[model samples]
Target chain A: MVLELARPRPIWQIMFSTHHTDVGLLYLVFSLLAMFVGGAMAIALRVELFAPGAQLIQDAMTYNRLFTAHGTTMIFLFLLPSAAAVGNYLVPIMVRYKDMAYPKLNAIAFWMIPPAAALVWLGMADFGWYANPPYSVISAPAPAAEMWIFGLKVLGVSSILSSINFVVTILKCKHPDLSLGKVPLLAWSFLTSSIIVLAAMPTFAAALLMLLTDRLGVSGFFNPAVGGDPIAYQHLFWFTFHPEVYVLVIPAIGMMYEIIPRFSRRPIFSHSSGVAAFIILALVSFASWAHHMFATGMSFTEKTVFMVGTLAAVPASAMHVFNFLATMWNGRIKFATPMMFAVGGIALFFAAGAGGVVNTAMPLDFITHDSYWVVGHFHLFVFGTIAFGTIGFVYYLFPYITGRMYNEKWGVVHFILAFVGACITFFTQHILGLFGMPRRIYDYPEIDAWISMNQLVSVGAMIILVGMVIFLGNMIYSMAKGKPANLEDPFGLGGKYYYPFAQRNPQHGEGGY
Target chain B: MAHSNWAEWIYLGVVTALLIYVGAEAWNVERIIDHAPADAEIIIVTGQQWFWTFEHEDGTKEVGELHLKKDHAYKFEVTSIDVNHDFNIPEFVVLMDAIPGRINTVWFSPNEAGEFEIQCREYCGLIHYNMRAKLYVEDV
Candidate 1:
C-alpha cells in the first residue's frame, strides 16, 4: 500500500542522507522539539506572572534569562526552523523537482541549527533577544552573551545558506513545463521568502559581529563611552528585525493561499493579485523597520516617514485578505479541520492587522509602546495568525507526507482549542496594555486592578498551553494509528486543486531542469 | 457554496476607511509634535541602575519620583548615566529613550491629579524590571 511504501526512512538514513526529503524530515523533527522547549519557557513565564509577585521563578536574573531564552528559542529555534521545514519539504515537491539544487548544502544548513540552539540555552544568555547595546556590550554576562551572539551568527549563516539553496532550487530546478506564472503560491512564497532571507540575514550577522567585538572591547561601534551612538544600534537592530516579521508572516500567508483554494473548491480569486501582494509586501518590508524605533527620538519628519511606510504595508495585506475572502465566496466551502484553521488564521490576521494599524500611527504608539499592548499585538500576529496558518498547512499536507489521514475528530478539537485559546490569551493582553501595564516585568506593582488583569492574562496563557498540548498529542496519535487516506483527494472535494503537489500531466518521471 | 461577491467590495471599503483614519491620526501626531507647550515646566530626568532622578526647574532634585502641577505642561529632558533606558510614564502616554550622553526631550501635560508610575521600558540590565519612578501631580 502507499502507506507501507511511504513509511519513514530508518534513523541512520534520516540522519546521514543528503536527500532533500530526509533532510526536510530532520528539520521538522528538530523544529518540533524546539517548539516544546520554547513552549516550556512560555509556561514558566506565565506561571511566574500568574500572580502579582514572583512565586515560581527564583530571582530576577533567572526570570530575565528565562524570557530571553524563550524569545530566542521561539523566534530562532522554533518559528524560523519550522517555516524552513515547511518550505524545504514542499517547495521542491510543488515545483515538480526531484531534489533541491544543493541537497548536501540543504542538510548542512539544517544540521547547524541544533548545535547553535544548544549553545544558546547551555550558556543561558540573559540579554533579551534583540540584545541592544550598551547593556549587551558592557553589562550582560560577557561569556554567556557572547555564546548567544555566536549562536545567532551560526543560525544566520545557516539561513543564508538555506536561502541560496532555495533560490537556486526554485529558479533553476523547477519543472521545465511549469512556467513562472504557473508556479504554486507556496513555491512563490518560499522563493520570495528566500530572497528576503538572503537580503536580511547578513545585516543581522554584521550587527552580531559588531556586538561581539563591542562586548570583547575590540571596537566601539555602539559603545556610548567611546562616542558611539546607542540609538544607532536600535536603527541597525530593527532594520533587520522588523522585516524579519514579514519574513515569518509572508510564507504563512502563502500557506493560507494554498489551503483556502483547495477547501473552497476554486482557484485563488486572483493569482496575479496574490503574487503582487507578496512582492509588494517584500519590498515594503525594508521601508518600515524604522517604525520600531519611533520612541528613540528621531525627528518628526523621520517619524512620519517611517509611520507612513509602516501603514503603507496594510494595503497589500488587505489585498491578500480580500482575495482570500473572494476565493472563499461563491464556493463549496469545506468545514474540514485544515479549512477551519486556515479560516481562523485569516480572521485573526485581520484582527492582528487592525492592531498593527493602531501601532503604526505615531501618536497611538506613545500609548502602546513597550506596553503589554505591543506584546498582545505581536502575539496575535505570531501565535493567532502565523501559527494558525502553519498548523493548518501541516494538517493539509499530513496525508501527502504520511499517506495516512489524521483523526478528523481530534484535528477539529485541536483547531478549536488553539483558536479559542489564542483569542483568550492574546486579546486580553491588549486591554491590559491599554490599562497601562508594561511588558517584560518579573513582578508588577500590587495595584488591585493591574493584578487582576495580569492574572487574566496568565489564565489565557495557560489555556493556550493546554491547546498546544492537545495539538502535540493529536500529531503523535494520528501519525501512528490514523487510517490510510485516499491519495488523490482525501476530502473527496473532486476539485482540481485537491492535491497540492500533483503534477499537471501526471508525468511520473522527474522532469525538472 | 458561492455567494454574491459583495463582501470583497465591503472589505475594500473598510481598507479605504482605514487608510483615511491613518492619515488623520498621522496629522494629529504631527500637531502633537510641532506644537509642544511653550510655557511648560522643564525637568531634567536622569536614569541609572534601578532608579530615576528628576531635577526640577528651581534646582530641587528628587530620586525615584517627580512632582508636577496638574493642567501644566512639563517637558522632560531625559538621559541615562550608564546605558540606554526608556523614560515611560504609561498613564500620561509619554515615552522616550534615555541614551547615555544624549538627552531626548518629550513633553506632556497631566490633566488629572494622581500618582502615576514611570517604568523603564527598554531592557537595561538585570535590575531593569525594578527600574521604577513615581510621578505625583498636584491638583490646581
Candidate 2:
C-alpha cells in the first residue's frame, strides 16, 4: 500500500519522490547492477593475472586498462552506490520517517547513477579507461577515458543532491520517539556517512575536472616538470579515496546495527559510545589519507604521524567490534546466513585492518606500499568485510523488499563457498606481494613458485564466481517459485526494532527541530 | 542470530591463523645478517634514474666501482635519488628499489660479494636496462 505524499500541493511533489521506498529500491537496483559489472571486471583482472607472459588477457596495456576499469568501476560504481542504496532504504526506516522530506530530489539523485555508470565503464571499451589514451592498442583511439571522468562528475553532483536530502530529512523529519539518543544505530551511521560524502565528493569533483581539463589541453593541472608534481595528484586522489572508503563502510555499520539487535534480543549496547566512535573515526580517517602516499617521500615526521594514526584505527575499530560482541554475548544465537556473513565479515575485516597497520608502519609501508599485498589487503577488507556485510544485509532485507523468502539452504552454501574462496584467492596474494610482486603487473613466472599461488587465486576467484551464480540462481528461483511471505516478520524477530512505515506512529513526529 | 558474539569466536580463529602465518614468515627471513656474513663488506645503494647516490659510512660519492673494505658490515641506506628504480644484480637475490625522494636502506654483508652487478630496474628512459655498475669489495 504505497501512499503518495500529498503535501503542500504540487510544490512538495516536485521536491522528492512520491515515495521514498521506491527511491530506496531505485538505489538498490542501480548499485546491484554496478556490483555485477564490478564483479565481472574483477574476474577479468584475475584471468589476465593468472600467469606471467600469459596472453590470456592480451597484453600489458590491456592489463593496465583492465585494472583501472576494475578499480574505478568497483569504487565509483559498486561500493559507493551500494552504500547509498543501503542508506536510502534504511535511513528513513530508522529515522521513523515515511519518506525523505523532499521526494523530488530523491528521484533526481537516483536517476543520475545509471547514466554515469554507462558512460564511465560500458562506453569506455573504445577510449580505454586510462587517463593517457592510446595506452594499450596503438591507434586504438578511445575516448572512454574522457567519458569516465566526466561521468564521474555527474555522479558526484547526484551524490551531493542525495546527501543534502538525506541530511535535511534526518534533521527535520525523525519521529519524536527517536531522540538523537534513541535514534537507531544505523541512522547514526547514515548521518555520519552522508556527511562524509558531502565533504569528500567535491574534492573529487575538483580533481577529475583538473584531469579532464588537462586531457583537453585546457591546462595540465597534473602535469609535472612544469612545477606541477605528479605526487600531488596521488595526494589529491587519495584525499577523496580514503574518506570515500569510510562512506562505504558506515552503511555496513548501519546494517550491522540492524542485524545485531535482532539476534541479541536487546537494546543496543552503549549507543552513545558507538556514535562517539563513529565521529572520531570519521575525522581521523581524513588525516590517514596520506598513508597512500607513504612511498612518495613525505618526511619522517610526516610518515611517523600518519603511521601512528593509521595503526590507532585498530583500537577504535575494536571498540565497535567489542560493543557488537557484548550485545550478543549472552543472547540467543541464530545461524542465519545473513548473520553468518556479517559475523564473518567483521572477522575477515580484521585481516585487512591488520594489513592496513603493516602498511601504516613507515618502513614496512615503504616496501609493501604499491605491492599486491596492499591490493590483497584492501580486497580483504572491502570485499571480505564491507561487500560481504552488504550481502548479508540484503539477504535479510530480501524478504521485506521482495515479499519472499530465499532458499536458506542455498544461501548458506553460497555464503561459505564465496567466503572461503575469497579468502583463498586473496590471502595467497599477500604472499605473492611479500615475494616482491608489484601490483598491476601483467605477468609472473613459473619458476618463481608464484605460478602456483596465482593459479590458486584464479581458482579461488572462479569458485567465488560460481558461488555468485548460485546465489543469483537462488534469488531468481525464490523470487519466482518460493513461498510467499506472510506479510509479517520474515526475519521472524517481530517488530521490536524495525517498525514498518505502514503502521504510523503519531504525536512523535519531528519535535526537536 | 546475533553475529557480534559469534564474531568474537571468529576473531579468535583469525588470531591463531595470523600468528601461525607471521611465525612462518619470521622463520624464513630470520635477520639481515642471515643471507650474508657479518664480516663481509656489502652496501645496498638502491639505483635511481638521471643520477646515482649512496649512503655508506664514508658518504658514498666518488664513482667508478664503489670500493668497500673487506670483513666489515658496511651497509648503505639504499634509496632512489629520483624516480622509481631498483638495484638489481643477477648473481645475488637481493634487489631493492630506490623509490623517488624516499630511502629504503637494505643491508647485506657479502660472503663472496666481490664484484656485484648493480642494475636499474624499469626502463626509466632510453638509457634504462643498460644502466649498470660494479661493486668492488676489498680483501683488507
Candidate 3:
C-alpha cells in the first residue's frame, strides 16, 4: 500500500480520478494552500498594524482589500474546505461505503474551487466579507466587487453540490448493518452540517445575485436609493452566515470526538448526547441570525427574542465539551499531538463560548458589537478551536495518508507555539475592544492602549506564523523521508485502537475499493 | 447515571434562568435608551462618505464636530446620506446604524463635560478607519 501511494501516477490521472480518496487528497492539499495564502495576508495585516500608522501596507484601500480577501479566503477556502476534506475522506469510510454516492459530483465540486478562488483573488473586493449593501451597491469599485460576487456564487453552488453528495452517501449508501444511530460521530457531524449547508446556503446565493444586479443598476433589492432597504441584505446574509458558523465548527467538534476517545482508549462517554447536541445546534443556529443585527435598530421584542435564541445554543455546545471532558476523565490517555490539540481546542472553545454569551446579552452587545471584541471572539472559534481540531486531525491521519510518522517532538512544539500565540493575540484583542478599538479599521489613533495592544497582537501573529512554517516543514519532510508507520497499530496504543483501513480494505495492496 | 443527568438538568436550568434575566434586563435597558424626553432637543446626524454632519433643530449645520449641552437629554435622528454607517460613541455606548433612506434614533444625556470621540463602527469605505468626529459636551 505504501508503494502504491509512493509510485508516481501522472498528475492528470490523479486530478481526473473520481475516487473519494483522490478527491479528498485534492481537497486537503488545496485547502492547505489556501491556508498559507490567507495566513500570509493575516501576517501582512498584522505587520501593517504593528504600529498605529501603516508600516508595511501603503494605503487604507489596500488594507481593506487584504482583510476582505483574508476573511473570505479563510472562511470559504480554508475552514470550510478543510472540514470538507476531512468529511470527504472519513464519511464514506465510516459509513462502510465503497465511495461517495456520487464520485463524479464530488470531483466537480472540488474543481469549482480553484476558479472561484482565482476570481476572489483577482478581484480583491474591498467590501467586508459580509458585503453589506449600499456601500457594496453604491460605493465599492466595480469589476472587483462583481468578481467577488461571481466567485462566491460559484463557490456556493459547489458547496451545495458537495453537501448533496455527503447527504446521499451517508443516508443512502451506508452499509445496512450500520444503522443511523450507530454511524460514527464524524459522519454524524457531516450529516448535520451538510443538512445545514443545504438549508442555509441558498439565502446567500440569492442575496449575492441581488447584490450583483443592484451593482449593475438592474435591480434595487437592497439599494436604499431605489426604495429598498439595506437592512434587508443584512438579514439575508446573516440568516445564512449565522448558521454557516455552525457548519464550520460542528465537524471540528466531530474530529475531537474521533481523536479524544481513541487517544484515551475509551468508548465515547455519551454518544447519544453528542448526536443530540449536533442536531439541536443545527436547529438553533437559524434562530440566532438577528443577534448579529441587534444594534441595527431591531425592535425591542425582536432583540430580546434573538438574544434568547443565541443563548439557547450555549447548552448544546456545552454538551459536546462536557462529553469530551467526561470521556477523558480518569482514563489512560496518551498525550499525543492529536490529544494535545483536542484538549487545547476545548479550552479555547470555552473562552470563545463565554465571549459569545457576553456578546448575546443586548446591553453588552452595545459595547462589543463590531469591535475588536467580536473579532477576538469569533477568531477564537474559527482559528483557535476549529483550525486546531482540523490540524490535529491532519496529524492523526498522517500515517494513514503517508504511511510515515511525523516528528512527535516537532508536532508538540508547533502545538505549543500555536496555542500560546492564539491566546496572546485573541485575548489582547478582547482587551483592545474594551478599550474601544473597532474592527475592520485600517488605522487607529496612537492611544497608549491601542498602540501597546496592537503591538502585542502583531507579535502574537508572528509567533503563529513561525509555528505554521514549522508545521509545513514537518509535513513535507516527514511525508517523503520519515520512518514507515506500522500499518496495524499506527500510534502504538496497545490492543486494537480502531484503525478502519484494515476492515474496509482487506486487500491492502489492491488499491481502495 | 442519574446523578450526571441531574447535574446536566441543573446546569441547563441555571443557564436558561440566567438568560431570561439578562434578556429581561436588556429589554428594559433598550426601552430606557430608546425613550427620549418629550422636551429633549433634536439633533439630526447625517453620515456621508467620510464625515459626519449634524443639523440642529434651528437649521444650523455643523460638520465633523458636534456641540452638545451637558446634563441635557438630546435625541439624535441618525441617517446616512450615501451608504450605511454606524454612529458609535464607544465611551458612552451610543450606537445605531445610520442607513440611507431610514432614520434610526438613539438618545443620550451627557452627564460629564469633556471631549469624546465619535467614529463609524461599520466598515463603510476606504476612509472608514479615519471616519471620525469629535464631540464637545460643554456645560450650559
Badly placed stretches (over 4 Å) of model 1 are: A1-8, A496-513, B1-14
Pairs in steric clash, model 1: A330-B2, A330-B3, A331-B1, A331-B2
Worst 10 residues of 3 chain A by lDDT: A504-513
Error of 1 at A215 (Å): 0.4
Ordered by DockQ, highest first, the candidates read 3, 1, 2
Ranking by lDDT: 3, 1, 2
List chain B TM-scores, each candidate: 0.83, 0.62, 0.93
User: What DockQ, on C-alphas, does every prediction get?
Assistant: 0.63, 0.10, 0.73
* lDDT for each residue of candidate 2 in A1-513, tens digit (9 for 90 to 100): 122221122433323444666666667666777777778878987887676665576655556556666777777777777777777776777787777778778888887888887787665532222232111112223475666777878988988888888788787899877678677778788778788888887887887777666656666455532334445555776777788888877778778877876866766666776887788777877877888765444655676566556655555576577777777777776778788888888888778877876666555653565566877898897789888888898788777666678898999999999899989988988887776565555665444567778888899999999888888888879876777655456656555445563422221133210
lDDT of 1 by residue, A403-506 (tens): 67888887888888788878887888898889777778888878787788777877877777776788788777767777877876877788554334442211
Top candidate, metric lDDT: 3
Interface RMSD (Å), each candidate? 1.6, 8.3, 1.4
The sequence of per-residue lDDT tens digits that candidate 3 reaches over residues B16-53 is 68767767787777677766899889999999999999
What DockQ would you assign to candidate 3? 0.73
lDDT of 3 by residue, A1-513 (tens): 122255456778768887777788889999999999999999999999898786999999999999999999999999988998898888888998888899999999999999999999999999999999999999999789999999999999999999999999999999999899999899999999999999999999999999999999999998878888899999999999999999999999999999999899888888888999999999999999999998888877888889889989988998898889889887899999999999999999999998998898887887998999999999999999999999999999888777788999999999999999999999999999998898999889989889999999999999999999999999999999888888777787877755366433322235542
lDDT of 3 at A218: 92
- Per-residue lDDT of A82 in model 3: 91
Which stretches of candidate 3 lie above 4 Å from their native place? A1-4, A503-513, B1-4
Q: Against the true structure, what is each candidate's TM-score?
A: 0.95, 0.79, 0.97
Prediction 1 TM-score vs. true: 0.95
lDDT of 1: 0.82
Worst 10 residues of 1 chain A by lDDT: A504-513
